[model samples]
Target: MMRDQAESLRNMVKKNRSVDFQVISITSGKGGVGKTSFTVNLAYILQKMGKNVLILDADLALANVDIVLNEKPKYNLLHLLTGEKNINEIIWSSKYGIKFIPAASGFEELANLPKEQQMFILNSLQDIYYSFDIMLIDTSAGISESVINFCLAADKTVVVTTPDPTAVADSYAICRIISNYNTGNMELGLVVNMTDNEKEAERIYNATNNVIRKFSGKTIKYYGCIRKDEKLSKSIRERFVLTSRYPNSKYSQDLEIVAKAILEGNLPEKKENFWRRILNNWINLKFD
Candidate 1:
């Protein structure tokens, strides 16, 4: 029975290839919850597991994932949105085998793009969307219209929160907001960041789930939790992804599990695409 269920899950992921290409938007109710860190490391982890991943610096207000990787992007999502550059022209390969489209900086007006421009941006983004297996967007924190629009467009929405009471409360609020637009079977995952242990993370997840269940009759499943660690900050200071620079580190190990969970959710059948494998191998070798 367990094997049959696993096989069924894998088949479902294999058959449901749609547009927007599995946008996993990582957002937090408030800032400083390690949202960007989670996004960067998670993208790296997915790449390590042989998946073609694209990390978009969707946090237009304060884009820093490129900086965290100690990289200086030539172009950003804002440039793509404004027709300043093409998508392929702006994408740069990270050393960790993940391709990134950096968000253009110094754009206070980026969040308020006009409707026609917004549609154009979306269409341009969709043009090369299927080129990768996963498109992860590290969105700006908080419940702004920009954040809501990104979440709604994504197939999976991941909300990051810590073990703080206020953080938990805000997470519930975010979940309620997403629930309003999610009609049926859109997978929403939670990442409990900066926790002491799995028990603490589960406690936080349960607490937020309780609030969501009572208030909105919805349940937010956890993708995974990232433990609070000094090495994470240390790696940031060193200007490298923890998974690539410090694979033996605890944070790297946890991120590996998180990556596996994400892959399990998305590619349950474990069928390998020959072209993707060949392409990703070539890309990884070049970047490495």
Candidate 2:
């Protein structure tokens, strides 16, 4: 009887506990799909839900997470890599409780970073890996070497898209590239942004997955959809997060639904720290 009681207690504990860490990459097939906006606002929503969140502006050349948050970062990963700044010095904490790490621009984002440089980043961010419940990597759009590596290395990857044909094609392109690189069952999701209605959004997702089925067996989860809302654009112009500034906006509410879907989904199996997994993926990415 005691053994059965102890077994039941263990089951209860297992059910209550979540993964210690989760790394999700917010990527797009092409630019102008509102990927960064989703990243920042989603981080805010996650923070409000009592989870510590970190946003890594991994767009390489064009880092915009800071701009979306209305923050001009004085230091980025390049500074940390050069020993010009410490880990704590470069992180920009928002008033909403999430942390932001902007990427280095210009020469620093060129091509794939050197292995040594990659290791420098891994070492520098070691502390941060333990401090946050989740790290949202806002990767640059397209299937560039670095971007592909970022998407694949993540525990979960959400491909943001619009209902436009080109956007859908581009979204499929990235999903195809990802599947080509890793033939495993990756935890991939789709977020349709800038849609006029839910049906339109679901149609885009279904069509994209239908094509993805041709070249690869992998399918993407339909997290949720965001309707086209002028408030989001206005909030960005004011350098404020839409969800934080106007929580009741349709865009914000849609994003909250997406965030809840993500949190409710099955987390991908991961056994190592995010940076370490990134380092390994970096080694595998072949630059042109």
Candidate 3:
């Protein structure tokens, strides 16, 4: 039964090849590093650029994308996984014109869902695979099995970090772990957040890049940085996206540049079926 469903999903992908949706996993090594904020703001900017976007709040436990967006979702991924609802029912459209898949907060079983259930959720996404131009996955922090699997399964992974030494160290650890997997078609990149200036961002990026290259022999593409801005905190308190609240703010402009870089990059054509590749990786995932 599962095999038949998987086959059907593959055909759906092949038929919608022209849509060319890009799936990007945004993650970090430690919590409270502005990872989710970056994800939300980026989606907002992309939508403003006339690109259809969807955010999958992959942080199973403590999921808060909906909270950040100031919108309440009727359903979440847990409902979809448990067969209580379909994918469309769980996806909520934000006022910013972008859509998102909310995850259940404090759900332990969801954090470590069984392999079969994981595939079931991935297979369910086929119905809307071509519905958007970009799918941004906001994965949880740390180098857990779930984090690594989510990063590996995406078309690209953006590792977010700050100028703090501990954050840089943790970012390197996650990058090293992801480097172990032969990411055939996946692009690995880094985003330096909370920098005082461009120079500080470069220093942090170079430091993290040096460690990864020296220890893991993996190259990480630089995706620019976001400087420290006081207005960012104010926007957060107001529960409004920084881009929408202060489009000319430095933080918002910086994210606009990053989004432009991502849009300019050449994503490889889909050589294999999307869901098939994701399920194959999920089934053979290793955590050691």
Query: What does candidate 2's lDDT look like per residue over 102-210, in tens digits?
Result: 7866764434676456555545555566678898899888887777777777888899999888998999889878876764334788999999999999988888888
Scored by TM-score, the top model is 3
How do the candidates rank by lDDT, highest first?
3, 2, 1
Cα-lDDT of candidate 3: 0.82
**Local error of candidate 3 at residue 227 (angstroms):** 0.4
Evaluation by lDDT, superior candidate among 2 and 3: 3
Clashing pairs in 1: 10-268, 10-269, 76-102
Stretches of candidate 1 off by over 4 Å are 1-20, 266-288
Show model 2 residue runs off by greater than 4 Å. 1-19, 106-112, 270-273, 283-288
Q: Write the per-residue lDDT of candidate 3 for residues 156-227, one digit (tens) a residue.
A: 889999999899989988988888784566778889988998898888888878887897787788899999
Model 2 worst lDDT run, 10 consecutive residues? 9-18
Name model 3 segments beyond 4 Å from true: 1-19, 286-288
State which candidate has the highest lDDT: 3
Say which prediction, candidate 1 or candidate 3, comes out ahead on TM-score. 3
Q: Rate the local accuracy (lDDT) of all candidates.
A: 0.71, 0.78, 0.82
